[model samples]
Target chain A: MAVATQDSAVRTGRATRFVLYTVLLVFALFYLLPLFIMLVNSVKPLGEITGGSMIALPQTWTFEPWAKAWSEAQVGVEATGLRPYFWNSIRMVVPAVLISTILGALNGYVLTKWTFRGATVLFGLMLFSCFIPFQIVLIPMARVLGEIGLAGTTTGLVLVHVVYGIGFSTLYFRNYYAAFPTELVRAAQIDGAGFFQIFWRIMLPSSGPIIVVCVIWQFTNIWNDFLFGASFASGSAAPMTVALNNLVQSSTGVKEYNVHFAGAIMAALPTLLVYIVAGRYFVRGLMAGSVKG
Target chain B: MGFLDINNATKSYGSVQVLHEVDIEVEEGEFLVLVGPSGCGKSTLLNMIAGLEEISSGEIAIKGQVMNGVHPSKRNIAMVFQSYALYPNMTVGKNITFGLEMHGVEKSTRDAALGDVAKLLQIEQLLDRKPGQLSGGQRQRVAMGRALVRDPDVFLFDEPLSNLDAKLRVDMRTEIKKLHQKLGTTIVYVTHDQIEALTLSTRIAVMNGGYVQQLGTPKEIYDTPSNLFVASFMGSPSMNLIPVTVRVEGNAVYADTTTGDGSPAALAFAAPSEVLKSYDGKTITLGIRPEAITDPEGADRNSTHIQSVETMVEVTEPAGSDTFVTCTLGGQECIARMRADADVQPGQKMPFTINMEKAVPFDPETENRIA
Candidate 1:
């Protein structure tokens, strides 16, 4: 009788899950509609973009907007020989992601297992900064960067992004580390492992999921940041986000929505490429050790 | 001089002391088990000996050498943790050979050591598997193998079997005992399970509230616990402690209590004058093992002057070779072991005899045994 009840309960659960999937599929389409519309508009001619509906495909597809955006928008390269701000974004974002992820793991390690006076206070400060609005710090950060002679360079932007990125990265790392059994650390200590030895050899190797989270989070944040890029980068050093803003609203003529849509697609490609390449690791990372379930 | 000596070892976090001046000397190649309840500081003392925690005020010496400043690895000690703590990224072979690799053992010798240890643990077939692929018991064996590969001077086990299922725990218990017998290495194990302590230890230390209540051979601790805590903590179907008064009747001291039959049951002891002078008329706790209180005619019989009480059996449990009968006496419930086929039923009045010779007296207020 209990088994029969359990079987029916399972059937009901499956029905519930099927309904949930239907709802989620509808929500996914809702969330993805803008991106789909932009992709379709990017391939359309100028007349098609203005004359047809937003979701309609172009009768005659053209690559003219892509080519124009690549050159005129200075996405591929610029006149100053610095290469367009687009490639510069990659150079800055990659290093920022790597440094932030490594340092995030280190921060998590120190905060969780290692004990020191005022450690909790330091952690509280990190969490406190996450609640502060970025607009409030803009003026002060600009003055500080100007004093340090980093006001209009890639270094200033990377530095600022790392500082803002540490707040969330540390949170991801600390929570994950907390779930790990302390007995493992105690056993490692008993086996004669020092602080860094245990972190590098034991803890870090099992931390694939958290590392992916940190990388994806920091990468997207630094890559798509318009405020920091526009404020801190000047001339050819500015990133694609700042350049896209210029192309969309520059006072040269009426806005060219086709080129703007094409530029937006190019701007979003790096992050999309990363998600596609590392998607497996992303899921595996989040659900590490959950196979026991 | 002992192989390991913990002298006046006490530990405290800040204000509350966890271990109060515990002293014990472990002999060479002796398997010693420290057993107690959760907050008993058995693990704390074990951690202190492993150099994982600082000794609050006392000295811990291994083989007559002070170990306070020595690192855990430098102390020539190996530990098997409950969680196994195997390097998750390393294969079973590398996990077992990690200590050797750390000490820079040559690749060929490391491989040989790994092979020998893996074979000893019967994990030769699991050499290439990561920790995630192994079951709980297998991971534990790998942990033990990692500890054993180094062949350290002393082995420290901190509840290594607590994570296994009941059957696996029993199996691993036997395996650990057999391993200890084969290696004949000095081992200091800690657990809250009394049966494990009784079965595995050359000596058992019963701890409570940061104090070593008693330390003796298993038989000695079981037969003659130094206090009420040791007596109750070290036994299953724990020893029945009845609060009774010792009264002097002429030259003999008799423990007097109301029997289940509503008649006074009295146990007379030819009082050793020196031990009985203070308790001439005061109430004392009479400690008796369930086996000691048995059927009238049994393997060991109490002398006629000892005592006999007739009580209605409240419950009877037949456990294959023996029967456990619980009866009430003097408002306290007492359990007794009798022959499996005893002609007794629930609610039947039967005279259960008490062997006063094996009974010990405890000071009612202090709970310590009256020596």
Candidate 2:
């Protein structure tokens, strides 16, 4: 009787599954409708996008707006477009993500494995950093950036994102490294491996899934960050999000919705690509310590 | 001086002392096991020897050299952890050779050591597989192989066989004993299993609540425990401690106690000690192992001092190899080991033999054995 109930539970009824799939598909379409509209409108001419229904297929598809958004749109008093800011975001996000992830991993290692007095309190404080609103840190961060002589520079933006991203990445790696067997660390220690040697050879080698999680999280967050970009580094060093915002807001003549749509897609492309490549690992990393070894 | 000496060692976190002043000198090639219940500081002692934990107040010396502040690696010790602790990312071969690599041994030398250990452990075929892919026993072997390849001054094992299933645990226990025999390296092993401690160690340090309760050979600890704790902890169907009053009548020593029916009974002692005379008319705890008290037919032929007691068998457990007969002595139920076919039944009168030569008396106040 238990087996029969289990079998029925495992194999849902046809009507139930049909309803489940229907609900799932509806939710999927609901979430994806904006992206569908953006993609549909980005390829159309300015006239068709401004005058026609957004969900409608373009009567005449063109890549001119994409080219304009990529290189020639007026962004922040200049028609230099988002190309420079795309590279700027790259320069900022890459270092920011790498530094934050590595530091987070090190912090996690020390916090979990090389624990001392008040380590839990330290971890609690770091976790508290994750909850602080980005707006609250704006003035203090800008002042720190200014004091460091990095204000209005891509390096300044990188520093800003690194500071912001460490909390989350550390959180990810800490929980992951917490589940990591301290026995292995002790074994390595007895084997004559020093602190950095164990971290590099033993801990880091097995930190694949969580590293992916941290990197993806940091990348998407730093890449899509407009608030920090607008606050500290607002000039030629603006990131993709900031530049895209400018390209839409700094329009003087006609409201180029197609160009704006193109710029938004360009701004979103990296994180989307990141997810496409590492989405499964993200889920797996999130669920790492939920189950047993 | 012995090979490894833990002198006046104690561990405390702030105010609470976990391990009291412990002193144990392990001779070269001695297999010393620290056995105790959980939270008994056996593992803490092992870790201190491994240099994984600090010896809070005292010193540890290895080969006449002080190893208190020395790093675990510098101390020349290898440890097998309970979880096996094999580097999950490394293959078994790499896992075995990681220590050598860390110590800057040449690749050829490391490989040679790894090969010898793998061959010795009969895990040569499984060297390329990761620890995750290995069975619990195989992982245990690889863990040992890692320790063995290092050829340290001593090997430390922290409950190494605790993770395996019962059958595998027994097999691995024998394997570890065999390994110890093959390589006469000094070892300090920690386990809560009394049987493992008995079978594996040349000398067993039975610890309780951080103090070394008794330190002796398996025979000494089993046959003649120093205290009630050691007496009760070291044996299976742990030594039945019966409350009896010592009644000295001239030279003959007798334990004046009640039978199963609450009637007065006197069980005589084979050899009376001066301490037994001192405990005259005073209550004492009598310690007797289950096997020592058996049916008359199954009693040890070598033991000449077998005292017979006719008692009501309150319970009889027929455990395939031997029947465990529970009988009340001095108002407390004591279990006796009998032959599988022994004709004993619950609530029936049966003649149970107590080997007085094997019985020990403990001071009721001190809980220490009365020599």
Candidate 3:
């Protein structure tokens, strides 16, 4: 009787495992289906892509469109081309991420650990700014940037990204700071660490999860910023996203689909790299501030 | 000279007052424990002394120097947090020497201090390990070492042992008392544990509702609490407070009450009736600690204001050293502590003696001591 029961239990366990695997496989396919189609279409010739099944493998793969998208597009003349646009995006996005993250960390530190008059009200105002539509302030912000001669420059784009980025960054940091046990800050205070000292020596090192959140959020927002890049830059100062659009537009003139595909891939590579490297931090930030009052 | 003096200190958050006008004075090399329940402002008062929290009004001076606006580091005081907030990024040795390094102490001097404190805390072997790799007890020791290495004017602890397990808490309590004896630094400790307050403090300030209810030696706080809160809060299993009406018969004072097993017992006091004459026919609360109520055989007859009562032992807990017999008296549950070997069982009728000689009377309406 015991042997029969053990066999039944093993069968049940196998059935459960089979069902879990089937569900996971179905979910993975649901997300991968689009990417698979895109990859095959991007490699296929126009005839093969138009005359075959959308799910069919490409009959012939070619790198001609990628090459055409690069040289003939002359994307660098407008901004930095694909190469300089990549560098420009890095230039604009990196500093935007760093400055916003630092400001967010300091704001979160003070808001969470220190008590001052009207701090909550000021935080409330910052929070309210997050919900305001970006379109509402576009004209006024453009005028302000133009008046300062930053309207068409990479520096102006970075400044704009940081100003807009502070709202969400502050939110991320404040929530992250809330989960951090306040006793640690208090202990540092008692150890004689002043404001910046504690922030630099103590809080910053322990801020792995929040820094990931800030980097991922700011990089994705600033790097993929088509609206700001296009609106602010009319000359050789556009970010890679704007330059990628111009590449696609000019690619049709030369019939260069492969270079457009490569440039599209290039435009996305930095954010993809950021996500891959800091994916753990993104998940940790979600879990770190789970317990709050 | 007194090492720490808090003169008329007051604190509040917005309009919600946490601590009222308060005053305390500690002599040099005194171990004072401030104990109260959560939200009683014990931690807040400790923070005020540590300069972690601002005092809304009043002066705090350490070593005869005014410390009102002086930063915590400049105040030259060290504090051990309840959470054992060892910097997670640093090794144990680094954590211990962080304060010294901040103050620009010579590296050789800092190393020597670290060596001495590590050996003192018996954490010499664990010096290189990060705080995350250590157990809770080890992390606590590192926190203490961090504060101890500072060798400041005073050491403030905010419920430092509350995070440890029961056995470790007892061991750490003794270790702290020993450390105090050896260092002889003025220490102000805060805890909600009465036993910790009793064993570790030279003087204890039992606080309630932001007020220091009583500041006295442990025995005084235990035996003669200033009011009902202190009387009820000081002892474990707490003092039993039964409402009773005072009656006088033939120049004798008697408190009439029904025993546990449906029997009447009148407990009498031998003191002069005049001491309680004004309370005749008035309702009052009587406070009696569990240990004060003993078995009849072990009772101190001369000193005992004995009340023989017939009470059914509803529950008997034998905790090795003592047997706790909980019985119902006058419809109120009362616990009595007696010898463990005493033949007592649940659902058995036992004759217990009430030691009323040290019983205190409290005003029922005001919750204050009547005498």
Clashes of each: 2, 0, 7
Error of 1 at B180 (Å): 1.6
Error of 1 at B85 (Å): 2.3
Global lDDT scores for all candidate models: 0.84, 0.92, 0.84
- B259-329 in candidate 2: lDDT tens per residue? 89998888899898987899998899999999998988998999879988888998889989999999999
| lDDT string, candidate 1, B75-180, tens digits | 8888988778888788989888777776768999999988889889899999999999999999999999989988888899999999999999999999999999
Clashing pairs in 1: A209-A285, B18-B210
* Fnat of every candidate, listed in order: 0.57, 0.95, 0.71
Comparison by TM-score, 2 against 3, better one:
2
A best-first ranking of the candidates according to their TM-score comes to: 2, 1, 3
- Residue range B298-346, candidate 3, lDDT tens digits: 6766884677777788888889999988988766888888888888889
The C-alpha RMSD in Å for every predicted model, in order, reads: 3.5, 2.2, 4.0
Compute the DockQ of candidate 2: 0.90
Report the C-alpha lDDT of model 2 over A1-293, residue by residue, as the tens digit.
97988777767788998999999999999999999999889899988866878889999989988999999988867778789999999999889999999999999999999999999999899989999999998888888888989999999888888887888988988899999999999999999999999999999999999999999999988888888888888888888888888788873888899989999999999999999999999999889999986
Q: Which stretches of candidate 1 lie over 4 Å from their true place?
A: A1-33, A47-55, A72-83, A253-255, A277-293, B249-251, B270-273, B301-307
Candidate 1 residue lDDT tens string, A139-248: 99999999999888888888888888888888778877877777777767666678888898789987888898778878888898888888878666788788777677
Q: Please, what is the TM-score per model?
A: 0.91, 0.96, 0.88
CAPRI band for model 2: high
